[model samples]
Target: TPLPTSSPRSSPNILITGTPGTGKTTAAGMVADAAGLELVTVGDLIKQRNLHDGYNEEFDTYWLNEDKVVDEMEEMMAGGGMCIDFHTCGFFPERWFDLVVVLRAGTQQVYDRLKSRGYKQNKIEENLDCEIMQVVADEARESYKAEIIMELTSNTIEDMEDNVEKIVAFVNGFRSSHK
Candidate 1:
């Protein structure tokens, strides 16, 4: 199916994506608040909506049904002014977002965060590997226009503050341009 175009809304739709433990949820909350956008945490949405096909024991997570997720999000995304947060982005339609922010962090920081969350060693290692390899960033590049894809570091509280400021600025700019 051809992707639906972003509808003309008062604010832009933004996608904040990265490997798990990269502070996507935190940054998204701040951005959504600052920019007056709604925050959609994909993982939480999946669970709340039963959008997953089943659970994965090894991963200790749901096996997401990507198509279902896209369908569930289609209308909201097209309307714009949403901050979509997820660890992966390639499955979402390219036209849904006005901007895609791929957050990254130091390996040690990711490791500490995941470990503190009680993630299994294997899962933690897998995420660390993904972070080291820039998997999420690469996926964003492949999924969206390069000009709209931004890579930001999220290693410290200072970095989070700076990132939120930058993202809010972008949102303001988008609002002005769209107006």
Candidate 2:
């Protein structure tokens, strides 16, 4: 199916994405609340809508069906004003987002967070490697315009707060310019 073009809306659609333990969800919620945008946690949406093929034993996560996810989210994404949170960003249409925030955390911080969440040793190691390698940030660069992508450190509470502030400011700027 052809990808839909982004439609006009009152506010911009922001995408918060990174590796699993990088605080994507927390930052997304803060930015959404502070900027008055709707929060769409893609992981929750996938679970709620059964938008995945099946669960992956190794990763202890869903094998997401990208087509199904895009089909379900296309209309809402096109309309904008969404703070979409997920661990990855390559599949979504490039035009669907006005800004993409790629959160990054220190390897030790990511490892601790994943471990606390009960991630298996292998899973935790893999995620730490991915974060160290900047895999998600690379994906964002490949998928979106450089001007619209922001790579922010998410290692501390202060970093999270700063990220939220920067994003809210971006939203305000977007609102004014797009109007």
Candidate 3:
């Protein structure tokens, strides 16, 4: 699908986020490709730029320097046509995203998904808990306007397709209004 012709002033900045194993990266890539937007993943960016503060052996995840990551991303976020994929959304400035999509999946589904990826039992359980608690969605709500925050399920291919369509329509609408 061709990208919506956004206002000359700016292109839309979209964020796709959710708990680990919730298909955030997959959906973000699909949406970005369908919408002809550029895809930027927080983890990839951090690793590429060596922006991590340190590594956490317990979680097997990097401790990113939040401020440094934000600073590095400021330019890309401002440039637009960017679909950002990440597990955390609250750290980003609200104005940076035109829309924030929070993907949800059931605890068992998340646990299964993570386990399939060789995640430790503890990590899998922790992520399942995060999903169950709606932590990411709550963070998006606190960061963005009600109209700009959308929650979608990522439990199946059909759900993901539906979410991509919804996002396209939303971007079209946002562009129309801005124009």
Off by over 4 Å in 1: 1-7
The runs of at least 3 residues in candidate 2 whose Cα sits more than 4 Å from the true structure, single-residue gaps closed, are 1-7
1-179 per-residue lDDT for model 1 (tens digits): 11223447668889999999999999999999988999999999999999999999998999989999999999888778999999999999887888899999999999999999999999999999999999999888888877788789999999999999989988887777777
Report the C-alpha displacement of residue 144, candidate 1, in angstroms: 0.7
Global fold similarity of model 2 (TM-score):
0.94
Q: Rate the local accuracy (lDDT) of all candidates.
A: 0.90, 0.89, 0.83
Q: Name the candidate that leads on lDDT.
A: 1
Candidates 2 and 3 compared by lDDT, better number:
2
Clashing pairs in 2: none
lDDT by residue for model 3 (1-179), tens: 22333334356888899999999898888888888789999999998898888888888889978888899999877767789999998888877877788999987779888999999877887898899999999988888777777888889889989989988777666666666
> Candidates sorted by lDDT, descending order?
1, 2, 3
Report RMSD for candidate 1: 3.8
Q: Is candidate 1 or candidate 3 better by lDDT?
A: 1
Segments in model 3 whose C-alpha atoms lie over 4 Å from true places: 1-9
Clash count in backbone of candidate 2: 0
TM-score of each: 0.95, 0.94, 0.92
Native-structure RMSD, model 2: 4.2
